[model samples]
Target: MTTMPRYLLSVFGPAARTDYGPYPSKEDMLQAFADTGAFNDRLQREGYFVFADGLEPATTATTVDGQGESPVLTDGPYLETKEHIGGFWVIEAPDLDVALALAADGSKACRGVIEVRPFQTAESVAALLDS
Candidate 1:
């Protein structure tokens, strides 16, 4: 049997950092977590779950760039955006349509925008690095 390809579902929401955006209330936060856990359980039962997690606020982020002996390290995210990725999930799906369906559930579960994209294969990553 052919295996399904993996896809990444990125969840974006208002930044939790008070310096950046309005943070959700404690009740809402707990509810979101509960909903997400149920969703994850469903995905697991369906054999679609790979890995998933919620992330800390962007203020805790450090950006490292520069392709040299000593890479450049900077504070904050690489992009200045209104919304930041609050969480992510790696899932196996048969096609983009299935991935999109899963992303819809993820959106509801996480109470955020869910962006789905396919994972690049090892060969593709090697080619990109070489180029």
Candidate 2:
């Protein structure tokens, strides 16, 4: 049987010093999204683009507790580290090579770590689709 081609584009970044920019200001990234609308539209037409989106800043995030006295919800992320996950995508491609090539283009275009991960089996993906 032929397996479906899917990739997870996990956009990672060095959360420490220096600038991660669409250049001019904090909203510049938003502008970039608006500006790339045409490019993205064309990608969608190609049938290789399935879905895409972004994430909130590393701040303004919260962590959850599962087992405890009260299932205690925390006020922020569980941990802090430099490599922050900024955003991601689920795309359709022919194979790993094509997925990685797209990841390279995404990495350069966004100037961040565009990680291309192969989708796991149905068991793993079911949780995502169900939600």
TM per candidate: 0.84, 0.70
Candidate 1 TM-score, C-alpha based: 0.84
The residue ranges of model 1 lying beyond 4 angstroms of the native Cα positions read 16-23, 122-131
Off by over 4 Å in 2: 1-3, 16-39, 123-131
Q: Looking at model 1, which ten-residue stretch has the lowest summed lDDT?
A: 15-24
Residue pairs with clashing backbones, model 2: none
TM-score of 2: 0.70
lDDT for 82 (candidate 2)? 66
Error of 1 at 128 (Å): 9.4
**Candidate 1 Cα deviation (angstroms), residue 29:** 1.5
lDDT of 2 by residue, 1-131 (tens): 86557889988876553353324555766655654464457558877788887776666577878777777776756778867777777888888898888777776656567878887877677988998
